[model samples]
Target: MSLIAAASFFGWLVGPLAGGYLAQYGAAMAFQVAAVAVFLCMIFVATVIKETHKVSNEQSFLSLFKSNNSLTLLSHPNILNLFVLQFFSVLV
Candidate 1:
């Protein structure tokens, strides 16, 4: 799973350089190819991917970012405090 994730990220990372070169060569099919490649990625995720956690429910995007779920013992509180303090310090 980790390897697959890494490879997917690597492909995304290099995609623009490859596509730009292909477009300069006037292959014209370059954008279509990239779109198809993305579609194929969706298929791969649907069929081959499994949840990493043993038990996990998918969360909504807004809820994921907005949740107070980060309040915590190991790391969250002071980190958030420092972050908020930085924001105020910058504004002041």
Candidate 2:
């Protein structure tokens, strides 16, 4: 998890610097490069990834949304606090 976080932080820092270099070619070239990257990523995920989590027969995926389960989860104190903090941070 820490590795993922550190890599994500570095990617965010590096992406714009790399994009700026790509942008010198043309605005359209930058977008074209991004599109190809996304296409390669899609292919990689489709071929290499497998479902790891087991689903139970008793529970339907939509059960959370079918009842008030989602609303109840949102009303949890920790989640509610996180939402409030996020809202205020975004406002700033």
Candidate 3:
């Protein structure tokens, strides 16, 4: 968790520096560069990464939302209480 937090913090810190460097060229060029970088990353992930988890034939991903299962889960007392707390916290 700490590693994730640190990485996220550093990413936020460095992102502006990268943008600032790119902005010296032009806003349009900066946007194009960012777009190309994202495209390259997507391609790399799609080609290089393999899925490890095998899904059972019987269990579909939509099983969680089938019937009233999703509603039933959300309507639990503990979940309702958490929702209420979150609402109040955000309201404040």
Candidate 4:
């Protein structure tokens, strides 16, 4: 978790600087670079990342979105705090 957080922090820190440099080439070029990066990330996840947990065949995908499970998660203090933080961050 610490490594993940550190990596995320560094990514956020560097993203703006990298984007500013890329933008000098042109807005379209910057967007194209971003799109290619996203495509490569998708490909990496699809091929390199392996699923460790066996998903139960019985559960429909929609079951994952059931309100009861969501409410249960929100009932936790830590989760609720995180939710609120994310909500306000998006507003900003």
Candidate 5:
């Protein structure tokens, strides 16, 4: 957990510097580089990452979006409070 936090800290620290350097070429070049990096990361995750959770084959993907599931989560007091807070915050 500490290693992950440290890596995330360094990533935030260096990202702007790297982006600024890349921006010297052009704003479009910087965006293109970012897009390519995201694509490569996606590819790496798809190929190299192992799934830890065992998903039931019987469950259809659409079932995951059922209203009951959403309502159940919102039934929790803290989560519901946070949800309302977020909703009002956006309007402000």
Candidate 6:
């Protein structure tokens, strides 16, 4: 499952190169084909993909942010100060 998810990202990256090549034919055809392919992929996932989480059988929107293990990540005090500085820099 992890491998397939990783490959899907790679596929997304590669797909546009093909689509860009196709676009040289016509902008309309390129978009139309991409839309059709995306719809087909949705159909495939709906029909074939299954919930395979080994830890728990929880399936919902909560499943999306499904980070299981929680630990005290803020053990270092400097990291929090760094985060605040980073956020403030982005404000401008």
Q: Provide the clashing-pair count of each candidate structure.
A: 0, 0, 0, 0, 0, 0
Q: Which 10-residue span in candidate 2 carries the lowest summed lDDT? A: 64-73
- Identify the runs in model 4 with alpha carbons over 4 angstroms from their true place: 61-63, 73-92
Instruction: Give a tens-digit lDDT track for model 5, residues 65-86.
Output: 5744667788889999999999
Output the worst ten-in-a-row residue range by lDDT, candidate 5: 59-68
Look at candidate 2 and give me any clashing residue pairs.
none
In the range 1-92, model 3's lDDT, one tens digit per residue, is 99989978987887678889999898887788878877997999899999899856666657745843755666689998888898899999
- Which candidate, 4 or 5, has the higher TM-score? 4
TM-score of 3: 0.64
Sort the predicted structures by TM-score, highest score first. Answer: 3, 4, 2, 5, 1, 6
> Could you give candidate 4's per-residue lDDT for residues 1-92 as a string of tens digits?
99999988987977777789998898888778878878998999999999999966676767766843667788889999999999999999
The superposed Cα distance between candidate 3 and the true structure at residue 72, in angstroms, equals 5.1
- Supply the TM-score for candidate 1: 0.50
The deviation in Å at residue 60 for candidate 4 is 3.7
The 10-residue segment of model 1 with minimum total lDDT is 65-74
**Model 5 residue pairs with clashes:** none
Which runs in model 2 stand beyond 4 Å of their true positions? 54-62, 66-71, 74-92
Q: Estimate, for each residue in 6-77, the C-alpha lDDT of model 1 and write its tens digit.
A: 998998878877888788767667888888988998999988998786727688877776664555432667
TM-score of each: 0.50, 0.59, 0.64, 0.63, 0.56, 0.48
Question: Compared with the true structure, what per-residue lDDT tens digits does model 6 show for residues 50-73?
Answer: 867665665566554554323233
Error of 5 at 75 (Å): 4.3
Model 5 misplaced regions, further than 4 Å: 1-9, 60-62, 67-92
- Top-TM-score structure, candidate number: 3
Candidate 1 or 3, higher lDDT? Answer: 3
RMSD of 1: 5.5
Flag clash pairs in model 3: none
lDDT score for residue 90 of model 6: 100
